[model samples]
Target: MNKSLITNLVAALLLVAGVLLNNTLLSLVGLFALSGGLTNWLAIHMLFEKVPGLVGSGVIPAQFEAFKNAIKTLMMEQFFTQANIDRFVSGQDSQVHLHLQPVIEKVDLSPSFDKLVDVIMNSSFGSMLSMFGGASALTPLKEPFVLNMKQSLIELTQQESFIELLKNQIDQPNVMAEIRAKSKKLLMPG
Candidate 1:
């Protein structure tokens, strides 16, 4: 078991023993046990509450909201952004196989491939070719496109900031808070 579980179990055991023994020494042990158990309970409670009757407690959630926000910001910036994957291009001079995996791990390549096929079919060249050709003519294009996308993603991941930003963002409150506090005086609405 983990340290917390072990400590909790020990506290419970001490409390039970102390209550059963019924003496001054046992009372002291009971107090120690109770303090541990109560403190742990209060700590857990404070995580989600403004503890109704407490004198000064239950500020964990509100006070650390920035910590939660920073985590959300990290998730959005690193794993849910289109810009992260779109930079990886390998097609023509400007076109690239933007890998969605970096930002969107859940990608359905078939739909995209099908959309490409539809676009090709709707094009003038595609219409002329299809008038005399078959759908099999475009089957060879799918794998190459997928492979190009893979290569582009590989290229983008090599950027140092891609992974570094995760740590940098986590550490931002410590580094940027001072700078932000100082810069705030510049905006006095004069």
Candidate 2:
């Protein structure tokens, strides 16, 4: 049922018929087909296993360390370079947009509002806010405050310093070492 099995079967039949009929050409063709199929099978097997007396076998597992290093080098050199990161961050296609809507939506600003009320109560405006029911008077400003904070964060990310800071962090020796360690663990997990 396997392709190799079928090929071997046909080759065997050809060889048998050639020998019984004394046909040298058929015999040669069958031998070629059999050898070709066997060679292909052996090559495929050698890729993942070491065959005795075969050179360059078991390549994948044997050179796994080298492969890991190569991958790390490739990523750091080609993908994570400062210029490449800056290009991607500042690209006109807008492929990278910093969205903080979900974060802003989940934030509880009540504690902050209460703190603000405390500061205001201790200040000269304490008497004025007392008539307005203290911190509850600021409840109406929560939405606008959150929206302004989110907008400010988005604007900050567009600044050159933000991109430089990101690049600097990624380029740090410790961060790069940590990345390599994680990648090695992933490739050769015990």
Candidate 3:
């Protein structure tokens, strides 16, 4: 039925015919054919089936778990690492836009305005402001200043040049590594 069985049968017939007809050539050919065919068949069999007194046969079925683990180790160590993933993401052709408007809008700019007022008061302008009702004169401008600052930040962040700059910085090797490290730390905190 199978090639190995058919080969063995043909070889045995040749051997018998050689012996009957007293032909050395046929005998040697038959011997070589039988040996080679049997040897190859045994080797193929050993890969998937066990045999008595054989040291390393049936390796696939017997050590399937180890084989699976080896494949997993190879993929994780060589292909699926953080650096590899970063390279894949950074190698994309499309633009990377960072939407920071929400964060910018949510930021409290009152402290920044207060700092500006303090700086003005500490400078030679302090005496000039005292005559205009001290820092209260700037009080009416606080809400407008905060709103304007937030709007300016949102506009700056939404600019194409700013987005491109951010993309370049993020794509840098050191910055990517730091981001990966921080993300890993957050995901797998100890």
On TM-score, the candidate that comes out on top is 3
Better of 2 and 3 by lDDT: 3
Local accuracy of candidate 1 as per-residue lDDT tens digits, 6-110: 776777677677778766676677578768777887787777688788754666667676766676567655743444322322123354433435663344466
TM-score of 3: 0.52
Provide the global lDDT of candidate 2 against the true structure.
Answer: 0.74
The residue pairs in collision within model 1 are: 89-96
lDDT value, candidate 1, whole model: 0.60
Model 3 misplaced regions, further than 4 Å: 1-95, 183-189
Task: Evaluate residue 102 in candidate 2 and report its C-alpha lDDT on the 0 to 100 scale.
Answer: 65
Give the lowest summed-lDDT range of ten residues in model 1. 84-93
Rank candidates by lDDT, best first. 3, 2, 1
Question: What local lDDT does model 3 show for residue 161?
Answer: 85
lDDT of 1 at 91: 27
Model 2: CA > 4 A from native: 1-45, 127-190
2 against 3, candidate with superior TM-score: 3
lDDT of 2 by residue, 32-114 (tens): 88888888988888988988888999998899889978986777677666555555545533566455446655777656656
Q: Give the number of colliding residue pairs in candidate 3.
A: 0
